[model samples]
Target: MSTLANETYEARVVAASEPGVTFSGALSSEWIKFRTLRSSWAVLLAAVVALVAIAGLIGYVTGSKWDGQLDPEDRVASAPLQGLFLAQLLIGVLGVLFVSGEYTTGMIRSTLAAVPRRLPVLWAKGVVYGLVTLSTLIPTTFLAYGVAQLFLSHFGHSTSLSAPTAFRAVLATGIYLALVGLLGSALGWIVRSTPGGISLLVGLLLIVPVLLEVVPGQWAKDISHYLPSAAGASFYSSLQADGALSPGAGLLVLVIWVAVATTVAAFLLKRRDG
Candidate 1:
Protein backbone atom coordinates (compact mmCIF):
# COMPACT_ATOMS: atom_id res chain seq x y z
CA MET A 1 0.00 0.00 0.00
CA SER A 2 1.02 3.62 -0.56
CA THR A 3 2.49 5.75 2.24
CA LEU A 4 -0.73 7.73 2.57
CA ALA A 5 -2.79 4.58 3.01
CA ASN A 6 -0.25 3.27 5.52
CA GLU A 7 -0.50 6.49 7.58
CA THR A 8 -4.28 6.30 7.52
CA TYR A 9 -4.13 2.71 8.74
CA GLU A 10 -1.74 3.62 11.52
CA ALA A 11 -3.93 6.49 12.65
CA ARG A 12 -7.04 4.34 12.69
CA VAL A 13 -5.24 1.66 14.63
CA VAL A 14 -4.15 4.23 17.22
CA ALA A 15 -7.66 5.58 17.53
CA ALA A 16 -9.05 2.09 17.94
CA SER A 17 -6.51 1.26 20.63
CA GLU A 18 -7.33 4.34 22.69
CA PRO A 19 -9.62 3.87 25.73
CA GLY A 20 -11.98 6.58 24.52
CA VAL A 21 -12.07 10.00 23.01
CA THR A 22 -11.51 12.57 25.71
CA PHE A 23 -13.66 15.66 25.47
CA SER A 24 -10.61 17.86 25.82
CA GLY A 25 -8.86 15.99 23.03
CA ALA A 26 -11.90 16.34 20.82
CA LEU A 27 -12.01 20.05 21.63
CA SER A 28 -8.35 20.50 20.77
CA SER A 29 -8.79 18.65 17.48
CA GLU A 30 -11.85 20.71 16.61
CA TRP A 31 -10.06 23.89 17.54
CA ILE A 32 -7.27 22.98 15.17
CA LYS A 33 -9.72 22.27 12.38
CA PHE A 34 -11.75 25.45 12.98
CA ARG A 35 -8.77 27.73 13.45
CA THR A 36 -6.73 26.47 10.51
CA LEU A 37 -9.54 26.80 8.05
CA ARG A 38 -9.09 30.02 6.07
CA SER A 39 -12.79 30.29 5.48
CA SER A 40 -13.59 30.36 9.18
CA TRP A 41 -11.23 33.22 9.86
CA ALA A 42 -12.37 35.02 6.73
CA VAL A 43 -16.01 34.82 7.61
CA LEU A 44 -15.42 35.78 11.23
CA LEU A 45 -13.36 38.78 10.22
CA ALA A 46 -16.02 39.80 7.74
CA ALA A 47 -18.69 39.60 10.39
CA VAL A 48 -16.68 41.84 12.69
CA VAL A 49 -16.04 44.34 9.96
CA ALA A 50 -19.65 44.39 8.92
CA LEU A 51 -20.78 45.00 12.45
CA VAL A 52 -18.31 47.81 13.11
CA ALA A 53 -18.18 49.50 9.72
CA ILE A 54 -21.84 49.37 8.94
CA ALA A 55 -22.55 50.69 12.39
CA GLY A 56 -20.32 53.67 11.72
CA LEU A 57 -21.98 54.26 8.37
CA ILE A 58 -25.42 54.07 9.82
CA GLY A 59 -24.37 56.33 12.62
CA TYR A 60 -22.93 58.84 10.20
CA VAL A 61 -26.05 58.89 8.10
CA THR A 62 -28.40 59.16 11.01
CA GLY A 63 -26.27 61.69 12.79
CA SER A 64 -26.00 63.76 9.63
CA LYS A 65 -29.61 63.52 8.58
CA TRP A 66 -31.49 63.54 11.84
CA ASP A 67 -29.17 66.10 13.42
CA GLY A 68 -30.58 66.21 16.97
CA GLN A 69 -34.00 64.75 16.44
CA LEU A 70 -32.93 61.18 17.32
CA ASP A 71 -33.40 60.23 20.95
CA PRO A 72 -30.23 59.47 22.90
CA GLU A 73 -31.34 56.09 24.19
CA ASP A 74 -32.93 55.13 20.90
CA ARG A 75 -29.92 56.15 18.87
CA VAL A 76 -27.43 54.19 20.96
CA ALA A 77 -29.68 51.21 21.53
CA SER A 78 -30.73 50.48 17.98
CA ALA A 79 -28.22 52.01 15.59
CA PRO A 80 -25.15 50.02 16.62
CA LEU A 81 -26.98 46.75 16.41
CA GLN A 82 -28.08 47.43 12.84
CA GLY A 83 -25.05 45.54 11.59
CA LEU A 84 -26.26 42.30 13.16
CA PHE A 85 -28.75 41.85 10.32
CA LEU A 86 -25.88 41.10 7.95
CA ALA A 87 -23.38 39.90 10.53
CA GLN A 88 -25.78 37.25 11.82
CA LEU A 89 -26.20 35.81 8.35
CA LEU A 90 -22.45 35.78 7.90
CA ILE A 91 -21.74 34.01 11.17
CA GLY A 92 -24.81 31.78 10.89
CA VAL A 93 -23.78 30.51 7.47
CA LEU A 94 -20.26 30.12 8.78
CA GLY A 95 -21.70 27.95 11.54
CA VAL A 96 -23.49 25.82 8.98
CA LEU A 97 -20.46 25.45 6.75
CA PHE A 98 -18.22 24.56 9.69
CA VAL A 99 -20.00 21.24 10.06
CA SER A 100 -21.62 20.57 6.68
CA GLY A 101 -18.41 21.36 4.88
CA GLU A 102 -16.70 18.46 6.59
CA TYR A 103 -19.54 16.23 5.48
CA THR A 104 -19.41 17.58 1.97
CA THR A 105 -15.72 16.83 1.75
CA GLY A 106 -16.10 13.36 3.31
CA MET A 107 -13.89 14.38 6.23
CA ILE A 108 -16.55 13.56 8.81
CA ARG A 109 -15.70 9.91 8.49
CA SER A 110 -12.18 10.61 9.60
CA THR A 111 -13.51 12.84 12.38
CA LEU A 112 -15.85 10.13 13.65
CA ALA A 113 -13.10 7.60 13.26
CA ALA A 114 -11.16 9.62 15.79
CA VAL A 115 -14.17 9.93 18.10
CA PRO A 116 -16.34 6.84 17.87
CA ARG A 117 -18.77 8.00 20.54
CA ARG A 118 -19.86 10.81 18.10
CA LEU A 119 -21.50 13.19 20.56
CA PRO A 120 -18.19 14.65 21.70
CA VAL A 121 -17.45 15.64 18.14
CA LEU A 122 -20.68 17.58 17.93
CA TRP A 123 -20.28 19.02 21.40
CA ALA A 124 -16.73 20.07 20.72
CA LYS A 125 -17.68 21.73 17.47
CA GLY A 126 -20.48 23.70 19.10
CA VAL A 127 -18.44 24.63 22.13
CA VAL A 128 -15.36 25.66 20.20
CA TYR A 129 -17.27 27.60 17.59
CA GLY A 130 -19.58 29.14 20.13
CA LEU A 131 -16.73 30.31 22.34
CA VAL A 132 -14.78 31.65 19.41
CA THR A 133 -17.87 33.47 18.22
CA LEU A 134 -18.85 34.79 21.62
CA SER A 135 -15.38 36.01 22.45
CA THR A 136 -14.84 37.71 19.12
CA LEU A 137 -18.25 39.33 18.96
CA ILE A 138 -18.32 40.66 22.48
CA PRO A 139 -15.45 42.95 21.62
CA THR A 140 -16.88 43.53 18.21
CA THR A 141 -20.10 44.51 19.89
CA PHE A 142 -18.27 47.14 21.90
CA LEU A 143 -16.42 48.33 18.84
CA ALA A 144 -19.65 48.65 16.93
CA TYR A 145 -21.22 50.47 19.82
CA GLY A 146 -18.28 52.84 20.07
CA VAL A 147 -18.15 53.51 16.33
CA ALA A 148 -21.83 54.31 16.09
CA GLN A 149 -21.63 56.42 19.20
CA LEU A 150 -18.75 58.39 17.75
CA PHE A 151 -21.04 59.67 15.04
CA LEU A 152 -24.05 60.17 17.28
CA SER A 153 -21.89 61.83 19.92
CA HIS A 154 -21.19 64.68 17.55
CA PHE A 155 -24.92 65.26 17.36
CA GLY A 156 -25.31 65.13 21.16
CA HIS A 157 -27.57 62.06 21.04
CA SER A 158 -25.26 59.24 22.09
CA THR A 159 -25.51 57.52 25.47
CA SER A 160 -22.64 56.08 27.48
CA LEU A 161 -22.39 52.37 28.18
CA SER A 162 -23.01 53.23 31.82
CA ALA A 163 -26.50 54.36 30.94
CA PRO A 164 -29.18 52.10 32.43
CA THR A 165 -30.07 50.26 29.23
CA ALA A 166 -26.99 50.84 27.09
CA PHE A 167 -25.01 47.95 28.51
CA ARG A 168 -27.93 45.57 28.07
CA ALA A 169 -28.21 46.56 24.44
CA VAL A 170 -24.49 46.19 23.88
CA LEU A 171 -24.13 42.90 25.70
CA ALA A 172 -27.27 41.45 24.20
CA THR A 173 -26.03 42.35 20.74
CA GLY A 174 -23.21 39.84 21.11
CA ILE A 175 -25.21 37.22 23.01
CA TYR A 176 -28.04 37.35 20.52
CA LEU A 177 -25.68 37.01 17.57
CA ALA A 178 -23.73 34.21 19.22
CA LEU A 179 -26.96 32.29 19.71
CA VAL A 180 -27.92 32.80 16.09
CA GLY A 181 -24.66 31.23 15.00
CA LEU A 182 -25.15 28.39 17.46
CA LEU A 183 -28.60 27.79 16.05
CA GLY A 184 -27.11 27.63 12.58
CA SER A 185 -24.46 25.22 13.81
CA ALA A 186 -27.12 22.94 15.27
CA LEU A 187 -29.06 23.12 12.02
CA GLY A 188 -25.89 22.17 10.19
CA TRP A 189 -25.58 18.99 12.23
CA ILE A 190 -29.26 18.19 11.74
CA VAL A 191 -29.32 18.79 8.00
CA ARG A 192 -25.75 17.71 7.16
CA SER A 193 -26.09 19.24 3.73
CA THR A 194 -24.68 22.66 2.98
CA PRO A 195 -27.47 24.05 0.84
CA GLY A 196 -30.20 22.52 2.96
CA GLY A 197 -28.68 23.79 6.17
CA ILE A 198 -28.24 27.30 4.83
CA SER A 199 -31.79 27.36 3.52
CA LEU A 200 -33.20 26.14 6.80
CA LEU A 201 -31.27 28.72 8.83
CA VAL A 202 -32.23 31.60 6.54
CA GLY A 203 -35.80 30.47 6.56
CA LEU A 204 -35.89 30.34 10.33
CA LEU A 205 -34.19 33.67 10.94
CA LEU A 206 -35.47 35.78 8.07
CA ILE A 207 -38.30 34.17 6.14
CA VAL A 208 -40.28 32.96 9.13
CA PRO A 209 -40.65 36.45 10.55
CA VAL A 210 -42.00 37.75 7.27
CA LEU A 211 -44.29 34.78 6.77
CA LEU A 212 -45.84 35.42 10.18
CA GLU A 213 -47.14 38.78 9.00
CA VAL A 214 -49.74 37.13 6.79
CA VAL A 215 -51.04 34.78 9.50
CA PRO A 216 -53.51 37.44 10.63
CA GLY A 217 -54.18 37.09 14.35
CA GLN A 218 -53.12 37.95 17.86
CA TRP A 219 -51.49 34.55 18.00
CA ALA A 220 -49.42 35.34 14.95
CA LYS A 221 -48.35 38.59 16.45
CA ASP A 222 -47.55 36.88 19.72
CA ILE A 223 -45.50 34.20 18.04
CA SER A 224 -43.81 36.70 15.80
CA HIS A 225 -42.38 38.50 18.79
CA TYR A 226 -40.92 35.24 20.03
CA LEU A 227 -39.18 34.39 16.80
CA PRO A 228 -35.39 34.45 16.88
CA SER A 229 -34.72 37.83 15.29
CA ALA A 230 -37.52 39.60 17.10
CA ALA A 231 -36.62 37.97 20.37
CA GLY A 232 -33.04 39.09 19.88
CA ALA A 233 -34.22 42.61 19.23
CA SER A 234 -36.17 42.79 22.45
CA PHE A 235 -32.99 42.85 24.50
CA TYR A 236 -30.71 44.52 22.01
CA SER A 237 -33.27 47.02 20.82
CA SER A 238 -33.15 50.18 22.90
CA LEU A 239 -36.50 51.28 21.56
CA GLN A 240 -38.24 48.31 23.20
CA ALA A 241 -41.01 48.22 20.66
CA ASP A 242 -44.54 47.19 21.56
CA GLY A 243 -45.27 43.45 21.58
CA ALA A 244 -41.58 42.61 21.92
CA LEU A 245 -40.40 40.45 24.78
CA SER A 246 -38.67 41.81 27.85
CA PRO A 247 -34.87 41.56 27.91
CA GLY A 248 -34.77 38.60 30.27
CA ALA A 249 -37.59 36.79 28.48
CA GLY A 250 -35.87 37.46 25.17
CA LEU A 251 -32.66 35.86 26.41
CA LEU A 252 -34.59 32.84 27.65
CA VAL A 253 -36.42 32.53 24.35
CA LEU A 254 -33.16 32.46 22.40
CA VAL A 255 -31.45 30.09 24.82
CA ILE A 256 -34.41 27.72 24.64
CA TRP A 257 -34.34 27.88 20.87
CA VAL A 258 -30.67 26.99 20.76
CA ALA A 259 -31.09 24.27 23.34
CA VAL A 260 -33.96 22.64 21.46
CA ALA A 261 -32.17 22.71 18.14
CA THR A 262 -28.94 21.36 19.61
CA THR A 263 -30.76 18.58 21.47
CA VAL A 264 -32.62 17.56 18.34
CA ALA A 265 -29.43 17.61 16.32
CA ALA A 266 -27.61 15.53 18.94
CA PHE A 267 -30.39 12.94 18.92
CA LEU A 268 -30.39 12.73 15.13
CA LEU A 269 -26.60 12.57 15.02
CA LYS A 270 -26.56 9.69 17.43
CA ARG A 271 -29.17 7.72 15.52
CA ARG A 272 -28.24 8.36 11.89
CA ASP A 273 -25.59 6.46 10.00
CA GLY A 274 -24.17 9.61 8.55
Candidate 2:
Protein backbone atom coordinates (compact mmCIF):
# COMPACT_ATOMS: atom_id res chain seq x y z
CA MET A 1 0.00 0.00 0.00
CA SER A 2 1.06 3.62 -0.54
CA THR A 3 2.40 5.34 2.59
CA LEU A 4 -0.37 7.98 2.50
CA ALA A 5 -3.07 5.32 2.16
CA ASN A 6 -1.51 3.28 4.98
CA GLU A 7 -1.54 6.37 7.29
CA THR A 8 -5.19 7.18 6.45
CA TYR A 9 -6.27 3.55 7.05
CA GLU A 10 -4.49 3.50 10.41
CA ALA A 11 -6.22 6.72 11.51
CA ARG A 12 -9.63 5.32 10.58
CA VAL A 13 -8.94 2.11 12.45
CA VAL A 14 -7.92 3.99 15.58
CA ALA A 15 -10.98 6.18 15.46
CA ALA A 16 -13.24 3.15 15.05
CA SER A 17 -11.64 1.33 17.94
CA GLU A 18 -12.24 4.17 20.41
CA PRO A 19 -15.70 5.58 20.45
CA GLY A 20 -14.74 7.97 23.26
CA VAL A 21 -16.42 8.87 26.53
CA THR A 22 -20.07 9.79 26.80
CA PHE A 23 -22.79 10.41 29.37
CA SER A 24 -24.26 7.04 28.51
CA GLY A 25 -20.97 5.33 29.23
CA ALA A 26 -20.67 7.06 32.57
CA LEU A 27 -24.26 6.15 33.41
CA SER A 28 -23.63 2.52 32.58
CA SER A 29 -20.59 2.44 34.80
CA GLU A 30 -22.51 3.96 37.66
CA TRP A 31 -25.32 1.46 37.20
CA ILE A 32 -22.88 -1.44 37.29
CA LYS A 33 -21.23 -0.13 40.42
CA PHE A 34 -24.61 0.38 42.06
CA ARG A 35 -25.82 -3.14 41.38
CA THR A 36 -22.56 -4.76 42.49
CA LEU A 37 -22.85 -3.34 45.96
CA ARG A 38 -24.58 -5.86 48.21
CA SER A 39 -25.42 -3.10 50.69
CA SER A 40 -27.30 -1.23 47.99
CA TRP A 41 -29.47 -4.24 47.23
CA ALA A 42 -30.09 -4.88 50.90
CA VAL A 43 -31.17 -1.29 51.53
CA LEU A 44 -33.46 -1.34 48.50
CA LEU A 45 -35.06 -4.60 49.61
CA ALA A 46 -35.56 -3.26 53.10
CA ALA A 47 -37.27 -0.14 51.77
CA VAL A 48 -39.69 -2.13 49.63
CA VAL A 49 -40.44 -4.62 52.38
CA ALA A 50 -41.02 -1.86 54.91
CA LEU A 51 -43.27 0.03 52.56
CA VAL A 52 -45.45 -2.97 51.75
CA ALA A 53 -45.51 -4.49 55.21
CA ILE A 54 -46.18 -1.29 57.14
CA ALA A 55 -48.81 -0.20 54.66
CA GLY A 56 -50.67 -3.53 54.95
CA LEU A 57 -50.39 -3.46 58.72
CA ILE A 58 -51.76 0.05 58.88
CA GLY A 59 -54.67 -0.98 56.70
CA TYR A 60 -55.45 -3.93 58.96
CA VAL A 61 -55.37 -1.79 62.10
CA THR A 62 -57.46 0.91 60.51
CA GLY A 63 -59.98 -1.68 59.37
CA SER A 64 -60.16 -3.30 62.78
CA LYS A 65 -60.95 0.02 64.43
CA TRP A 66 -63.18 1.47 61.73
CA ASP A 67 -66.47 0.80 63.56
CA GLY A 68 -66.21 3.51 66.18
CA GLN A 69 -62.67 4.87 66.55
CA LEU A 70 -61.76 6.08 63.06
CA ASP A 71 -63.35 9.36 62.00
CA PRO A 72 -64.21 10.42 58.45
CA GLU A 73 -61.27 12.80 58.07
CA ASP A 74 -58.92 10.23 59.56
CA ARG A 75 -60.17 7.58 57.18
CA VAL A 76 -59.71 9.88 54.22
CA ALA A 77 -56.15 10.77 55.16
CA SER A 78 -54.91 7.38 56.31
CA ALA A 79 -53.37 6.17 53.10
CA PRO A 80 -51.13 3.09 52.96
CA LEU A 81 -48.58 5.65 51.82
CA GLN A 82 -47.90 6.41 55.44
CA GLY A 83 -45.33 3.68 55.09
CA LEU A 84 -43.33 6.18 53.07
CA PHE A 85 -42.33 7.68 56.38
CA LEU A 86 -40.18 4.58 56.84
CA ALA A 87 -39.30 4.09 53.16
CA GLN A 88 -37.85 7.59 52.92
CA LEU A 89 -35.33 6.89 55.66
CA LEU A 90 -34.20 3.66 54.09
CA ILE A 91 -33.95 5.06 50.56
CA GLY A 92 -32.22 8.22 51.74
CA VAL A 93 -29.59 6.20 53.58
CA LEU A 94 -28.95 4.21 50.43
CA GLY A 95 -28.45 7.42 48.51
CA VAL A 96 -25.96 8.64 51.08
CA LEU A 97 -24.01 5.43 50.84
CA PHE A 98 -24.11 5.38 47.05
CA VAL A 99 -21.41 8.05 46.79
CA SER A 100 -20.04 8.08 50.27
CA GLY A 101 -19.21 4.40 50.06
CA GLU A 102 -16.84 5.05 47.18
CA TYR A 103 -15.04 7.69 49.17
CA THR A 104 -14.84 5.46 52.21
CA THR A 105 -13.28 2.61 50.27
CA GLY A 106 -10.86 4.89 48.36
CA MET A 107 -12.46 3.78 45.09
CA ILE A 108 -13.38 7.33 44.08
CA ARG A 109 -9.81 7.87 42.89
CA SER A 110 -10.28 5.16 40.29
CA THR A 111 -13.73 6.48 39.41
CA LEU A 112 -12.44 9.98 38.89
CA ALA A 113 -9.55 8.66 36.83
CA ALA A 114 -12.02 6.86 34.58
CA VAL A 115 -14.05 10.03 34.08
CA PRO A 116 -11.63 12.92 34.13
CA ARG A 117 -14.34 15.44 33.23
CA ARG A 118 -15.65 14.67 36.75
CA LEU A 119 -19.07 16.30 36.61
CA PRO A 120 -20.44 13.46 34.50
CA VAL A 121 -19.74 11.10 37.36
CA LEU A 122 -21.96 13.08 39.68
CA TRP A 123 -24.66 13.40 37.04
CA ALA A 124 -24.45 9.72 36.25
CA LYS A 125 -24.71 8.71 39.87
CA GLY A 126 -27.70 10.99 40.44
CA VAL A 127 -29.52 9.86 37.30
CA VAL A 128 -28.90 6.16 37.84
CA TYR A 129 -29.88 6.25 41.50
CA GLY A 130 -32.94 8.37 40.76
CA LEU A 131 -34.14 6.03 38.05
CA VAL A 132 -33.62 2.97 40.23
CA THR A 133 -35.56 4.52 43.07
CA LEU A 134 -38.40 5.63 40.79
CA SER A 135 -38.70 2.30 39.03
CA THR A 136 -38.68 0.30 42.26
CA LEU A 137 -40.79 2.60 44.41
CA ILE A 138 -43.57 3.18 41.87
CA PRO A 139 -44.41 -0.51 41.62
CA THR A 140 -43.99 -1.00 45.34
CA THR A 141 -46.38 1.85 45.99
CA PHE A 142 -48.99 0.24 43.78
CA LEU A 143 -48.55 -3.10 45.50
CA ALA A 144 -48.86 -1.54 48.90
CA TYR A 145 -51.91 0.41 47.85
CA GLY A 146 -53.58 -2.71 46.45
CA VAL A 147 -52.84 -4.90 49.43
CA ALA A 148 -53.84 -2.25 51.94
CA GLN A 149 -57.10 -1.53 50.16
CA LEU A 150 -57.97 -5.23 50.32
CA PHE A 151 -58.03 -5.02 54.09
CA LEU A 152 -59.66 -1.61 54.21
CA SER A 153 -62.43 -2.86 51.90
CA HIS A 154 -63.73 -5.09 54.65
CA PHE A 155 -64.66 -1.96 56.60
CA GLY A 156 -66.14 -0.22 53.55
CA HIS A 157 -63.39 2.42 53.84
CA SER A 158 -61.34 1.28 50.85
CA THR A 159 -60.70 3.76 48.09
CA SER A 160 -60.20 2.70 44.50
CA LEU A 161 -57.48 3.91 42.13
CA SER A 162 -60.29 5.62 40.26
CA ALA A 163 -61.32 7.60 43.27
CA PRO A 164 -60.73 11.35 43.15
CA THR A 165 -57.06 12.13 43.73
CA ALA A 166 -56.25 8.46 44.28
CA PHE A 167 -54.07 7.78 41.23
CA ARG A 168 -52.24 11.09 41.55
CA ALA A 169 -51.38 10.38 45.15
CA VAL A 170 -49.97 6.96 44.29
CA LEU A 171 -47.93 8.32 41.38
CA ALA A 172 -46.66 11.18 43.46
CA THR A 173 -45.37 8.81 46.12
CA GLY A 174 -42.86 7.39 43.65
CA ILE A 175 -41.76 10.78 42.42
CA TYR A 176 -41.35 11.97 45.99
CA LEU A 177 -39.17 9.01 46.93
CA ALA A 178 -37.09 9.38 43.78
CA LEU A 179 -36.36 13.01 44.57
CA VAL A 180 -35.54 12.11 48.15
CA GLY A 181 -32.98 9.61 46.90
CA LEU A 182 -31.38 12.16 44.58
CA LEU A 183 -31.27 14.71 47.38
CA GLY A 184 -29.43 12.23 49.58
CA SER A 185 -26.99 11.38 46.80
CA ALA A 186 -26.23 15.03 46.26
CA LEU A 187 -25.68 15.52 49.97
CA GLY A 188 -23.35 12.53 49.91
CA TRP A 189 -21.23 14.12 47.21
CA ILE A 190 -21.01 17.35 49.12
CA VAL A 191 -20.22 15.78 52.48
CA ARG A 192 -18.27 12.80 51.07
CA SER A 193 -18.64 10.88 54.32
CA THR A 194 -21.35 8.36 55.10
CA PRO A 195 -21.98 9.48 58.66
CA GLY A 196 -22.01 13.16 57.79
CA GLY A 197 -24.26 12.63 54.79
CA ILE A 198 -26.70 10.49 56.75
CA SER A 199 -26.77 12.91 59.65
CA LEU A 200 -27.46 15.91 57.44
CA LEU A 201 -30.08 13.96 55.51
CA VAL A 202 -31.88 12.85 58.67
CA GLY A 203 -31.68 16.32 60.14
CA LEU A 204 -32.95 17.98 56.99
CA LEU A 205 -35.79 15.55 56.32
CA LEU A 206 -36.88 14.66 59.84
CA ILE A 207 -35.61 16.78 62.70
CA VAL A 208 -35.94 20.20 61.14
CA PRO A 209 -39.64 19.74 60.52
CA VAL A 210 -40.28 18.93 64.15
CA LEU A 211 -38.13 21.78 65.43
CA LEU A 212 -39.92 24.21 63.13
CA GLU A 213 -43.22 23.40 64.79
CA VAL A 214 -41.92 24.60 68.12
CA VAL A 215 -41.14 28.07 66.78
CA PRO A 216 -44.75 29.16 67.32
CA GLY A 217 -45.69 31.73 64.70
CA GLN A 218 -47.25 32.24 61.32
CA TRP A 219 -43.70 32.77 60.05
CA ALA A 220 -42.66 29.32 61.19
CA LYS A 221 -45.80 27.88 59.63
CA ASP A 222 -44.94 29.52 56.32
CA ILE A 223 -41.37 28.27 56.47
CA SER A 224 -42.34 24.74 57.42
CA HIS A 225 -44.09 24.05 54.13
CA TYR A 226 -40.89 24.71 52.17
CA LEU A 227 -38.80 22.13 54.03
CA PRO A 228 -37.81 19.07 51.99
CA SER A 229 -39.83 16.47 53.90
CA ALA A 230 -42.88 18.68 54.21
CA ALA A 231 -42.83 19.60 50.53
CA GLY A 232 -42.29 16.01 49.44
CA ALA A 233 -45.10 14.74 51.65
CA SER A 234 -47.47 17.26 50.09
CA PHE A 235 -47.17 15.37 46.82
CA TYR A 236 -48.95 12.23 48.09
CA SER A 237 -51.17 13.89 50.65
CA SER A 238 -54.82 13.22 49.75
CA LEU A 239 -55.97 16.15 51.80
CA GLN A 240 -54.00 19.38 51.81
CA ALA A 241 -53.50 20.74 55.28
CA ASP A 242 -53.49 24.45 56.12
CA GLY A 243 -49.73 24.96 55.77
CA ALA A 244 -48.90 22.48 53.01
CA LEU A 245 -48.14 23.11 49.36
CA SER A 246 -50.44 21.70 46.68
CA PRO A 247 -49.32 18.53 44.91
CA GLY A 248 -47.93 20.21 41.81
CA ALA A 249 -46.25 22.92 43.84
CA GLY A 250 -44.75 20.42 46.22
CA LEU A 251 -43.26 18.43 43.37
CA LEU A 252 -41.74 21.57 41.97
CA VAL A 253 -40.23 22.48 45.32
CA LEU A 254 -38.60 19.09 45.72
CA VAL A 255 -37.26 19.20 42.16
CA ILE A 256 -35.71 22.56 42.88
CA TRP A 257 -34.05 21.20 46.00
CA VAL A 258 -32.60 18.26 44.09
CA ALA A 259 -31.37 20.48 41.29
CA VAL A 260 -29.70 22.92 43.66
CA ALA A 261 -28.10 20.20 45.72
CA THR A 262 -26.70 18.35 42.71
CA THR A 263 -25.44 21.55 41.12
CA VAL A 264 -23.53 22.43 44.28
CA ALA A 265 -22.11 18.95 44.46
CA ALA A 266 -20.99 19.15 40.86
CA PHE A 267 -19.22 22.42 41.49
CA LEU A 268 -17.45 21.02 44.53
CA LEU A 269 -16.52 17.82 42.77
CA LYS A 270 -14.87 19.76 39.97
CA ARG A 271 -13.06 22.23 42.20
CA ARG A 272 -11.83 19.83 44.88
CA ASP A 273 -9.32 16.99 44.53
CA GLY A 274 -10.66 13.44 44.58
- Determine the backbone clash count of candidate 1: 0
Residue 107 in candidate 1, Cα distance off native in Å: 0.6
TM-score of each candidate structure, all chains considered together: 0.90, 0.92
Least accurate 10 contiguous residues by lDDT in model 2:
6-15
Off by over 4 Å in 1: 1-20, 68-76
Report lDDT per candidate: 0.88, 0.88
**What would the per-residue lDDT of candidate 1 be over residues 1-274, giving only the tens digit for each residue?**
6746636564455446656669999999999999999999999999999999998988777777675576655454666668899999999999999999989999999998888889999999999999999999999999998999899888776768888778888888898888999999999999999999999999999999999988888899989998888888887877777878998898999999999999999999999996
Instruction: Please report the TM-score between candidate 1 and the true structure.
Output: 0.90
In angstroms, the error of model 1 at 32 is 0.3
